[model samples]
Target: MAPTNNHRTRCGDTRFPRNVILLLVTIFVFLMAAISIAWLVMHPHDPGFAVTSLSVTNFSLSDSQVRGRYEVGLTITNPNKIITQVVLHRQGSLLLYDSELYSKAAVQTTVNLEKLTNKSVKVDFEVKDQHQKVVPPILGRDLNKGVVNFNVVLKVTVRFEAGIWPSKDELLDVTCKDLDLEFHPKTKGTGNLLGIGKNCSTKNAAGRT
Candidate 1:
């Protein structure tokens, strides 16, 4: 009779049913969490896009002897996800740091619409500085008191996929007065260059019609 009573008490334990239900619910929640985690790991976003890398480097000018082969280099990076149909087409104008010679080089940027994870690329630019025969009144005179700047200009066009990355026509204000008079001759070249004053120049528009 004592054993029988013990068995009945064990079977009637009210906490037993509650504990079993709680365990089942806990297991279901864990299973759901695991499945959700698996989905996130295996599936990518709709576009699967991310900015893995961003930088500007490898800028080189020609050997200074080549006539029109003024070579410039650039690089772009992408990592992880895939960027498809990538291309680069940069467009912009070069400017002088001063107001003397309108020496123009080329303002440019790199474009990559498609890239794979952890990838590096190089770009070669042929920065052309068109020489104008016309001479400026202050050809060699220091136009900016003691400030040095670029004396040339170049228009660049960088196109990637359906977007265009452009820069405000660079107002490259480079000072050259610190250089020795014998080495750095003070002479401004010819060209309609944009000056960096309170006003705006034609080269300041990132996207000009």
Candidate 2:
């Protein structure tokens, strides 16, 4: 009877630990499932960007340096159906020639976008002689041909607001590629962007599109 009692006690102790472990694992699984469901329900889509127009004035290339005044027009759209508003903050634009940054401008404005709505904004860059960047040989050659192809990149911090919830700030990169600026023959120093409704690609900081 004593041996049987001892054996029963050991069995009880082992069973207790196993039961506790099983309960913990079950709880963990349920918690993870709940978090996943919440994420799916609140997922927000990124906004879209399009280059509506680009204007260049006072353009000149001396030696290897380039100077110009640029105005970039953009159409920003919010495509999310559930998000109440999208706020874009601290925006900046970069002008690139063959992947090299030539000029940059700060957009000191906040953009508020409602759901399924679009807004138009313009970014201005004044590249004076003092702020001009030395152009690459390839860029100089393109300028001689009266048409120059450049890339416009927009960097912005974005936040999405739902009913009462606001998401964390996200950094986004918007790229408009192959923007051809054809210099006017008569004006000599002025040019306009060729192509209409050129769509820009947006990507997150993690390089996800």
Candidate 3:
């Protein structure tokens, strides 16, 4: 008699078990939910940045060059309960008549903020060794009007610390508009600027990193 052969076929061998598949799906849902909750809880309100004063020293324009020394005072207000670190770096410019008059020359000092605290910072800006090309337009203008209009643009990095997790830093675009100044012979072309009160706006909604 010839030997008999038996063959067995397996069904659905490559498919996952129903229980295992359910477990994986449940885990994915839970992870997504957690991330959503974290974001909602960590969302922060806009902080306050105001220019308290702007002082100028040795503001002069000659036939060859334009020179000026300036100091800008800013007050930072943190409204959140978490600690924050605000960094105003040197990456922007000062504009006069849409002209690039001065560049950011130094990094602003780092600020360590406590919860709901106010911090004051001063930025010193000076323009020297510049060409005379930007002077003719301003010199011919009436300085006796007692006001020169300027605009300042800056980029700041803000970091927040909450509980044990420090949120990723946020880059903010700060623009100070319509900084008007009057030159006085008392300071010999040096005086405090006007219209700098609460004239700054910060935009960070582009994206957070």
Least well predicted 10-residue stretch by lDDT in candidate 2 = 84-93
The candidate with the higher lDDT, 1 or 3, is 3
Q: Give the number of colliding residue pairs in candidate 1.
A: 34
Clash numbers, per candidate: 34, 0, 0
lDDT of each residue in 89-150, candidate 2, tens digit only: 43444455643444456445567887788899888876653544566777667776778887
lDDT of 1 by residue, 75-167 (tens): 233332433232323432223323232222343333443534322333233434445333233423443343323322223322212122111
- Residue 126, model 1, lDDT: 41
Q: Encode model 3's per-residue lDDT on 1-209: one tens digit a residue.
A: 65434322222433447668889999999977876687568776556788778777887766666677778788888888888889888766666666566556465768888888989998876777555564556643745556777677777888887775536578897778778777765556776776546557888858532
What is model 2's C-alpha RMSD?
A: 6.0
Candidate 3 positional error at 121, Å: 0.9
* Model with the higher lDDT, candidate 2 or 3: 2
TM-score, each model? Answer: 0.24, 0.71, 0.72
Error of 3 at 149 (Å): 1.6
**Which of candidates 1 and 3 reaches a greater TM-score?**
3
Count of clashes in candidate 3: 0
lDDT of model 3, residue 127: 73
